[model samples]
Target: ARAYRMEWPADMTVFEIDQPQVIEFKATTLAGLGAAPRAELCTVPIDLRQDWPKALLDAGLDRNRPIAWIAEGLFGYLPPAAQDRLLDNVTALSAHGSRLACEAVPDMSQVDHDQAREMMRRVTAKWREHGFDFEFADLGYEGERADVASYLDNLGWRTVGKPMSRLLADNGLAAIPQSNDSVSVADTVYYSATLSK
Candidate 1:
């Protein structure tokens, strides 16, 4: 995907990558590679899986340094087991002062397969036509209590959570239409967190 970037002065370092997921990683890697004006760009293979966190650790992602990891719009696409495994992997690999943020989608355990499939049927059908219909399991922390946070805490990281309402309000979005009318609506609520080991 092509994106237009605001140009910076020639002396400023810049990094660009073709994929949305790698943008920050590439930018950080670029800045780390040089003290002078420079840019580094690379495409991570899609076949790369959750092991990336461990790989980054092995590659010496600085634990003493604050790093940002994002799993945007990704949680629901993974099975519950995979979700847990990935988070566990990340927790094990992250260093002190590392911040990880993500939108905690509804865990599949909270969703009925029939309802979820029906609700997402159209998109799934479209993707299947294109030869890729990703199977999904919504999985994350259990509640406002932040299960993910507790899990991370056991791994020696301090944790904080940001709720979805606050995020929407920050971005000037009004309450979703018809959202407040039902207590039973599967909370698509997102829980975000920061952790420092």
Candidate 2:
């Protein structure tokens, strides 16, 4: 929303898609602010676990036009099959010049899932002590997911992968501190890609 408010080009439309509950919360919060959202901003409310592409199309997305897609902090939450399905849908909808930027998780098979889950539980409990009520372990899918870079490569997308530490340093930001379950915080990657002609 802030990006749409501050940086979206006038000629381009921006669609923000999320679960219905999240969308409802955002809508209500924006309404309380008493200011109209940008004309180019379209909020599409649908569960990604369902028929989200149809809902997106119904919300005025143009499949024929090129789009820049971002999936920051999202894929990790979905099951491996759901992740693949999302990519399939995006590929189906994308036009020739479509591009994507996403944050990629490391190979879950290489991580200690039990340790990671316990660490997250501890963090969540600490937060709950301060009034936040949410199960952190419920927020992510931990298993052997497909490699995002490999998947995109197989689809003929030109992709570049960078470590999160490099990305942060390039942007002059500090790297994330190491934690007990370093696999959860370390080894994250980022990818930028363009569809093949």
Candidate 3:
């Protein structure tokens, strides 16, 4: 859809990386909708925890060119070490001026883990009621993690971040009220980083 809206750039290729089942399901859904990719689309079916970097490169990712990577709702599913490793891999593969946009979870030191978990459960239950059955707790790895901005800054990437409430306000939307659960959208911190040339 994005490519179509942009009139399909011939020089650009979009890579979709995920587990085999997810890739298959996405393909099926797109085909069922009678949709075709407007730009070159390559699907790499593999778990992110595996050697996905190699798999991506094998699928013809051009590391020499600036890349734009988006990790929407991804880090919360990975362990702290895995998150660091993922960033390391991306930094290594990225050429100068590469861009990364990701969701950076907050430091949960002051958050009540039990309360947060319960609230998250409630959110997931509501989602299930609406036909979104993905298990938030079962798939997530909760605990302490490094500050994404600091990590990227040390890695020579200039980054800007905004919390969910700020994002809403900046975009002229009313902020959703959040309780002490800390697991709500109040905890969402999005970061956009660019590797310096």
Predicted candidate 3 versus true structure: per-residue lDDT over 169-194, tens digit per residue: 99999888867666567768999999
Report the C-alpha displacement of residue 141, candidate 2, in angstroms: 1.5
**Residue-level lDDT tens digits of model 1 in 71-178:** 666655555556667677766656566667666554355545565555455556677788985742122222222356666567666666556666667889775455
86-170 per-residue lDDT for model 2 (tens digits) = 9888888899889999988777786677887888899899999999999999988877888898898788688899988888889
lDDT of 1 at 159: 63
The top-ranked prediction according to TM-score is 2
Better of 1 and 3 by lDDT: 3
How many clashes show up per model? 2, 0, 0
lDDT of 2: 0.83
Model 1 root-mean-square deviation: 7.7
Say which candidate scores most in lDDT: 3
Q: Of the candidates numbered 1 and 2, which has the greater TM-score value?
A: 2
Candidate 1, clashing residue pairs?
107-138, 108-138
